[model samples]
Target: MAAVNRVFAAQLAGLPVFGPDGESIGKVRDLVAGLRLDQQAPRVLGLVVELATRRRVFVPMLRVTSIEPNAVTLATGSVNMRQFHRRPNEVLVLGQLADARAELGGVRVTVADAAMEPTRTRDWVLAKLAVRERSSRLGLGRRRSSLQVVPWTEVSGLSLGDLTEQPQGAGQLLMLFDTMRAVDIAATLRDLPVKRRHEVADAMDDERLADVIEEMPEDDQKDLLGYLAEERAADILEAMNPDDAADLLAELTPADQSRLLELMEPEESEPVRRLLAYSSDTAGGLMTPEPVVLSPDATVAEALARIRNPELPAALATMVFVCRPPQATPTGRYVGCVHFQRLLREPPADLVASAVDTDLPALRPGATLTEVTRYFAAYNLACGPVVDAGDHLIGAVTVDDVLDHLLPEGWRETGLHDVRSADPMKSEEWERA
Candidate 1:
């Protein structure tokens, strides 16, 4: 009944899901399969679609109208909104099966991909597996591993006993994460089992892991860091935003804080240590040491260029600080700041000092939470500069950080509901089937 009779599970990933009227719904994050106890091919259960609100839900295969190369059309827009939880007999194909060890024709191989096709009953089943030969035991005379596709029934070790509790690599999981935002990736990790979460984190590089860590809730952040070895944990801390790293470290015991700080490079640890010196509820504690700063003599074009960095957060790119001598924080005299809007109106070659906005007063490091909020409201500013007693720029606080502190504890976890509930289909719908 579908437009296509066969579809590769990997190709379905990241595809935009649409409703019958061509309305956009969500994107496919992974495929759910029901493993058979008799070693038969696993049945295709449904799709894990991440909605616009970042909530992931299940869409049964019977509701999927077509499996095209670029899109998956749903039979109807009215679907269950319950959060997806893997049942005892189910497994996430892309998340847990890819890179899993298996045997084909008595030869050991690794699952690289899988394919599903519709049977006469309109039920989809995992019919084929794309596998690669395992590398040689030793490095002496290793050759490139060859890849091939074989029937799922012929592949051993795909049953529930083989994959449900066994450790698997994250090769395919990382591929899906490559296209997601850091925040989305963090949310996805929160939904996975603790062991699986660590597997994915262990496979990630320091910089990428740091980005994901910064987006996670404080508790999850601390938990993941603790799971790593001391050296690797220190590297992750070094890669994180200094203020964020400090916040996470503050949660640990004082002994741990000192040990991690010692392991970090001196230059990298300096700002974090300085942040730790301040009270967590103060402006100095909430501000980030890495802000866009420029010397007074720099041109408007240069100021704009600095903020143009794709990696810079939207709030941090709102303006550029103009100081006297040292361009970095704790610089010379804190002259003033140039708003991003002002840079566009000024001549390219004109010095940034000419366009500086000096009317707004700077925030002191000791400014309380109430004082910071009042300052933001009074000035209608999205970001404010932090200065020491001598008027030296120390850091910049963005509105996002302020909101993070303002929100109640465990706010992130509160929004997520992970319960196993009954099917939404009515008795009438079931009777028709």
Candidate 2:
């Protein structure tokens, strides 16, 4: 068999695979490895090859005859061409593990890369991980950075479900997730098995769980809520955006929905209740009740500060509503809105009233989805305020929520949102976890 000392999983992926007769067969798409409790390292199962037909098939390690930088040669020209299917115990090396966070030698580090070593018997095993540690030194009044690689065995918190049982490992896992975006964390959780997904969710706090739940698909959101205790689920719902919370509640039976609503804080439950009053396809159902609102007399600086809230979605932060006294929805009276650009152009000390765009119109709560779509399209608005019969601003509909309603059904299950990179080393931002 042709030999190579070692190669990182990232480098091995995308290399062409060949038959014993030197005929091209396919290219490496990913590597499958079986997790073992008794062994410190995971055993390499095989390579996932994408054929010319765009179909993926499995090539066992035993069938591999030579390992080279450019191509992997199989022992025989004849091979099974069945499509590959993942076993319960197997995980994709490049797909799942390459950029995951791991604890190496008691220090948390990013798994920037991974390597595999060939065994004496001509098989290959996962050998080491290139863990990155970011450190800065003051040299000549300038900062200097360095990166270090660590052995895979030294990594203790790589496994997902293991954290559920190990207190220290759970803490490390939580810390790792603390640095990651909620959307990214949700994507990772969705890839894991149900049991592991529950374990990870159990370890997260209610606020963090709420953030991640908002990013999950409707089915996943319901599954996770169903798994949690009623009280815990209520608390998480309270923490989520009113629009998202209402959407999730709409999926449950009336009895369950009412029970959960009763368990939530009155203030938190009120907005959701009002939203639930509207049909799911209506503008009221798709809008968020907590848009930034200020009296026309409020200063530009105050409006800017409100929009600066990191938790606010980008579209909602683009404009601030100007309302009359009472200042809460149904706002005393809808006046106008000041776009963020107008706020920036005016002096901070200037009154928001001076910047109000009075020409922009608001949508009635009962406006149909098609009407909302036409409103957004005709005005090129990122978001539009929703009002009642008295012209009171109740909430605002964001473009994202509109698109979510308009997209094809079962879009989430089609893998349209799984954007994780298969090769970390080839990523533009490899240094990021």
* Model 2, span 1-433: residue lDDT tens: 6667778877776689888889888778678787766537777877877665545666777778888888899884334454455666677675556545556666666665567888886667788877665334435865532446556677876674552243321333455566567865665566555655776788889999999999888899999999999999999999999999999999999999999999999999999999999999999999999999999889999999999998789999998999997787778889999889889999999999999999998999899999999999999989899989998999999999999899777554333442322432232111111
- Which ranges of candidate 2 are over 4 A from the true structure? 1-32, 35-41, 45-86, 92-124, 127-169, 415-433
lDDT of 2 at 96: 54
List the candidate 1 regions with Cα displacement exceeding 4 Å. 137-143, 411-433
lDDT, each prediction: 0.85, 0.78
Question: lDDT tens string, model 1, 224-248?
Answer: 9999999999999999999999999
Model 1 Cα shift for residue 80 (angstroms): 3.0
Q: How many pairs of residues collide in each model?
A: 0, 0
Worst 10 residues of 1 by lDDT: 424-433
RMSD of each: 3.3, 10.2
